[model samples]
Target: MFDTTTTPDSFARVFTKGRLSIGLITPLEAYPESPFPTLKDHQQAAKQAEDASFSSLWIRDVPFYDPNFGDAAQMLDPFVYAGYLAAVTERITLGTTGIVLPLREPVAVAKQALSVDQLTDGRFVLGLSTGDRPVEYPAFNIDFEDRAARYREAIEVIRTLSENHFPKAETMRFGTFSGTLDMHPKPIHGRLPIMAVGRSGQPIEWLAQNVDAWVWAVDESAAIREILSALQTSALDGRPPAYGYSTFFDLDPNPDAPYQRFYNVVRIGRKALIERLLHHRDLGVQHVALNLKPSRRSAQSVIAEMGTHVLPALEAA
Candidate 1:
């Protein structure tokens, strides 16, 4: 089981052992026709989410826009945006869907994460991934094939710096930490909750032992159950880490419409969405971060509707 004593408030707010929490992914406005969002009223939208009782808000790291990939992904640096949001929203948990770990220096990553954690008053969660964009690797002079190794190394560097005082450590790709120097501003809690977004090129067993949580893009209940079962069986100390997923959501305007899927997006009515989420809760999913970029309506409208309708229903359920 997770040591609640050492976990940040954001981790507990977002991931309970048996319940499901809902969060909105940033660029929290719809831009169905283009790759980029206008980011209009972005701050207001964030505050709206907090006011609506949404469990958290997530930002994505898209360092470069590959027109081929077609999504610009919020177009702001995630850490900077997260810091900005920290000031505007008081209670909502702030997080990254993930930072592409291999593309950035690990020590800098640790500093930024701790800075956001402090700004949020212990309301930040750090999600990291081995990036999927092959085009991005060569641009950074990094080998695409070596990301898995680098990803692991980055996590070690971040953790060692966060959890220890003047921690002496040697790493293959990220240089060494001398015992004479220490990273400043340790996590407000003893540690920041590190979530692995997607497999990040690691085996399930490795994730089970290393990360505080795991999230991917899986859509089926049975598939989720199977993966959760595998994670439970492989977990260290017989305790499964929290599990969650992200989805491109397109909520139907009608409250009674049935759940429908279109590739990675789910186009469903509020009622069925509630049922689906409840099902996920029963299956042991700890969080669900919804990306509303695919919505036909304005993202603000969707947020308002879900807050007024779906969130209350989930609470009652």
Candidate 2:
């Protein structure tokens, strides 16, 4: 059970205990031929998503474009883009698919997250990761092998700064806070909903105890169930943190097309999409962030279709 009283509005809206909410990952466009998105009409797409009753919008932190890695995620600073989205949209929750924590300073990250939370009137969720690209570690002059410890340290620093006034804290990577000064712009809910995006070099037990939510990319139902069960068991005070996943989604133009899988992406009709989401909801998934980067159709068309047909049916369910 989640304590709604303490949950941030964005977290609460995007994740309910028994229901699954849908969100889209940005730059909400299809570019199957290339690794980088044009970022054209992105703002409009975000507005359209909100207008269509989408629950949230997610951004990724990919500071560099690794030709070998082959995906320049969103191609913008997540915090800056989030701020821009916060100003443009009225109600949709803004989130980071994840910000790679070990590659940046924790206190600055805390301030940026808090600022976004305040700007959105509590419609922000902070998702943190250890980062998958080892190349990024050296670029930031950070030790890749030490990310696990740094990841933990960053969480501690962020929490201490956000949840307490004039907090005193000592950390290994980040320096000590001696209670001489306080971090400004506290979370709108008194605590920001911190999510562990991917494992972040930590175990499920650590995530269950520390984060407010967990988002990964697992597809197997049994694996999801086992992981969710473990998370619930290890969670503090028996309150299971929210669980969800991201997938490359391609919604077929036809309403009745069968569900088909292609590696990480799923190409399905609106009807099948609804059924699949319902199945996930039953499996205890609280949210799903769909990536449209691999779609064959235009992003706007898919958004319109989902808004007109899929969302209402899911709401009725």
Candidate 3:
């Protein structure tokens, strides 16, 4: 969710009301491990997403890697990498596909995120999730079982730190505060937009009550429908829109190849991928972030293909 003290002007253009956006998630490919993205590919991909006219490029925050978890999410500190990506690209918004909330203290996270937001001139949007992997929890001495509660709490703490005449509120789990502590380098817009990763068992009312937007993941068709239904119910004035989606791509790029999806990764041709996304749109997905995970000769190749073959059609879809 976003800060009440902050206004819409503080957000990226994509955060404006009833908007539509398409973005790419990085790593930008399918990998069984965490630390494997090509340094060259990562930099080029950020520019390519912008050059291709995409609205945003999202990077994942995987604080700790659990090999058993099977996916490393490109293994970089998202905020630091975001700083790098911010410097490299001009317009495309930089996002954290998500930062796992329960893995670290909220204050450290908020300070760094604010720094990135300022560096990017307010082009930061954060995706947050209550971590699900059991292995990731214990490493931080946090109970994996109750992360959902901690997740909610972390969101609250971050918001308070990001806004509120800081030195005023005594910090708890995040950090100790003495006086009105204002986070340096305020958001370009005064607030950063937050997209809740999944309901995380928190209710649609809560999602509507909190996050600036909500995300649809995995292959759940009904999930997007449910979110839209809640958006209508949660309307305060003129129906506030809630984003919905499930990321997919033409991995393998072979139409005849038997399609498969793992970790939300899908293998299909560009045409099939478009159809599935359109289906989601019809169901009320206002924004969709593509993860172009197909087994291409290169990540840039997939980005090029999406720009040339997929994006144009989706614009009309």
Candidate 4:
């Protein structure tokens, strides 16, 4: 049984118990159906997010550009950008909206995660998943069908390395660690908070027992609540895993504009957005990363508005 009462590290604190916080996903600007974003001002924007009281900044892992996928998504390695962001920002949590676990080796994952953890002083959270893109699996020479097994094995290997030095681990897919070799710069919290992205082909019970939290796509509050309610009893050791989701949001320049739902986004004013976030908090969602790709306003403008209006409203709520 995993203990839920343990004090969370800084990264985990962004998604603290019984609280809801808002964050922005990178390439923070409004891309609007384009695969590219001008990243020259990323550092300045990140600093602004932290200063504005945004809880976290999320980076995504898209190793290669596929025409079918349509978006390159920051076009920088997530770990590299994470380290860069950690260096620039003072207190905002640096997280990977997700890194595809099966595409990379566990030892490398552990080392990179630990490096960022140490660099940020325990301000890193790893959102992990077994990737869904078939195009990438073949390019990496990994069998797509066996990704679930690899993902599970990789997690075990990472956990073993994080918790124990000179630990022996035998994995069916991730090879073996004979306790002879050990990795250094372990996570500042003994283990980094690993949030499982989507289903990753694992059962609810398994995820609840293993990962620190669950990351999902944003949906209607009622629907999201129904799903979470169903999983209430499946949590291992009677501690429900924290819930997070990615959402598309376009904050209108008009603060009083009415809410209008888009395909995957909700175009609304700050008042409506604050109400939505508060509703999600009531439904037990601890954190939500807002994707501004569909936004109508520039990232700078949106961030300013949110900082002045939306963020304060959430805090007050």
| TM-scores for every candidate against the unseen true structure | 0.98, 0.97, 0.84, 0.95
* Prediction 1 global C-alpha lDDT: 0.90
Encode model 1's per-residue lDDT on 230-263: one tens digit a residue: 9988998887789999999999999898988888
Q: Sorted on TM-score, highest at the top, how do the candidates line up? A: 1, 2, 4, 3
Error in Å for residue 246 of model 4: 0.4
lDDT score, residue 74, model 1?
A: 97
Q: Which candidate should be chosen as best, given TM-score against the real structure?
A: 1
Error of 3 at 232 (Å): 2.4
**RMSD in angstroms, candidate 3?**
3.4
lDDT scores for all predictions?
A: 0.90, 0.90, 0.69, 0.83
lDDT by residue for model 2 (1-317), tens:
34967665677789889988899999989887799999999889999999999999999999999999788978989999999999889999999989999999999999999999999999999999988789988888999999999999999999999989998878878879999999989988788888889988898889888988888998568998998899988988988789999999988888899999998888999888898889988999989999998899999999999898888888899
Give a tens-digit lDDT track for model 4, residues 1-317: 22555545565556776788888899878888688887968899999889888889989888988888777889999999999999999788888878999999988998899999899998888889886577999898999888888888899888898879899878887778788988888877777788888888888778877887787885687878876775677876567778888878888888788889877788898887788789888888888888888897889889888899888888887
Ranking by lDDT: 1, 2, 4, 3
* Model 2 stretches with alpha carbons more than 4 Å out: none
In Å, residue 2's CA in model 4 sits off its true spot by 7.2
Per-residue CA lDDT of candidate 3, range 50-151, in tens? 898777787877776666755566677888888988899988888776888878778888888888888887888877887556677777798777777777
Off by over 4 Å in 1: none
Query: Where does the lowest 10-residue lDDT sum fall in candidate 2?
Result: 1-10
Angstrom error of the Cα, residue 183, model 4: value is 1.4
* Model 4 global lDDT (CA atoms, 0 to 1): 0.83
